[model samples]
Target: MTAISETSAQMALRDPDVRVMLRVRADEPGAFAELVGQYQHRLVAVMHHLIGDATEAEDLAQEAFLRVYRARKKYRPRSKFSTWLFTIANNLARNSLRSRQRKPVTPFVSSESGSMGPHEQMVKDNRSGPMQKVQRKELADLIQEALAALNERQRVAVVLNKFEDMNYAEIAEVMGLTTKGVKSLLSRARMNLRAALAGYVYMDGAPAPEEESERPV
Candidate 1:
């Protein structure tokens, strides 16, 4: 994104969160805490779902907020606060994947220790029974395997499009690519997702029974 004029920046920053950002820009005491209160959970959720690593997701979410704090003085609200927020998150996720290449692929499931850590146990307990938990774990494993199959750029594009609800233009801006390039990336991503979720009813874009009444305009 290019720099904006001061007047335009001020105008755009009129968003309520941007006002809180202005406090951060001014280096107000405890402003960072306020910002964290506002965005931390959201950033963590975005990172976790995008990268599929809960531990690293927390780390990356912290780094994204730190970036926001460090750059606060120069912060211009040309985009929605969320767009800028996720742009930082997406960049960190890419870097994390690069570092991960040095290590082996590890599914989030626990090994033969026959024990789950606190987090794993909590999620496992929510599933219906032993059979359902195992099925859910298997499905999760398959999804991760499919995500691993994507090239980095395509993966980022898919995450932004599917999870973040970013349109082509915002995704292109975040990934630093052209609109046409983003279109191509999403096309490839859809193909990969189709392959990954072949039997899933979601691929057909049908809303589930509970959600049909809440359809968007």
Candidate 2:
């Protein structure tokens, strides 16, 4: 392994999550569980957006944590633990998608439980309209379709940028892309999403307003 620089090591030590990871590396009690508690929901949400399925997303997120725990012995904090974790997640999601493409696709199974699943949860979180004020379920389905229509890399970049609130650099790190490439990927994704959902969903001809990040590329 390459030696970590003193400054880099210090920066890693300063990160709260990195400190927790260090504890995990040392086999400290509760450290891995703490990491899971901190990131489980976020990873599930991100995976849901990537794969368009709640159950699979939950499974994939759990698998990510399992991999993290397995790798704890080799843990090295070069970046925030969240970044490293999501890099694993992003790779897994891509592989899952690719594996799906190679197999005969199965019919989608809707949840039997009465609780709102990830698709509804996502719409309720992102879209501004009250559920009672609109055809919320139908609209949610449309938005989910729009998001799913994006190519895998575009969908990943868009979800990381829009949902995870990751800036271009952070997204680039997770995706193994340059910041400029992330910007362009997201730009194309936004355009594709807009076109796919236009007239059918967002009738105003304006893109859904997203929180602006300062472009670093």
Candidate 3:
């Protein structure tokens, strides 16, 4: 079990939930560690996005997985395993944010590629556009600045939606927010980011409102 055969790993991943989890409860060697390796970075990045301090993010993430490991016996597989796993993450992040004397935030930077800060997938989504090179540098700087300026809840919503590609339910679970609440958070995040990056994205002689209104319409 130290090294799972590819076929075995694929089969395990495809198997029903209870089986894979039961494998974990039984300590079937790689079962537990595999789970850890698969989830660790994403979980940490989610926490880091919410709490903004990498040290605190790491601590909360450790607590989250430890909570998961401790709960293995009681873990009934009612949903996607990631959903349940992130429930623990959600709670831990909320608790950490509430208990802190000061809210924490991660400084955004472009060169560092550990999970793209926020809206990072935008780069890939628009990868081949004519403005790719210019957009990359502009977007990189804008994302870095915009992320730092967001409120915590908005920040988390943006990360989960824009970067994590999590659906509303998953984001709701992660933020301890209602789905509608998550929607509102995301809307505000978008508005704020649009405003923050307006100069970067829309400045370069793109339009003059009076000129366009007079000419086209």
Q: What TM-score fits each model?
A: 0.71, 0.77, 0.66
Which candidate has the top score in lDDT?
2
Candidate 2 vs candidate 3: the lDDT winner is 2
> Candidate 1 lDDT, tens digit per residue, 135-176?
555556556556656788987887778777889988998989
For residues 100-128, write the lDDT of model 2, one tens digit per residue.
Answer: 99998742333331366534543564465
TM-score of 1: 0.71
Cα-based lDDT at residue 57, candidate 1: 92
Can you write out model 3's per-residue Cα lDDT over 63-122, one digit (the tens) per residue?
887887788888655555776777788778777776773655345454544465345444
Total backbone collisions, model 2: 0
In terms of TM-score, which candidate is strongest? 2
Relative to the true structure, how large is the alpha-carbon lDDT of every model? 0.74, 0.79, 0.70
The residue-level lDDT of candidate 1 at 144 comes to 58
* Alpha-carbon shift of residue 125 in model 1 (angstroms): 24
> How many angstroms is residue 101 displaced in model 2 relative to the true structure, after the best TM-score fit?
0.2
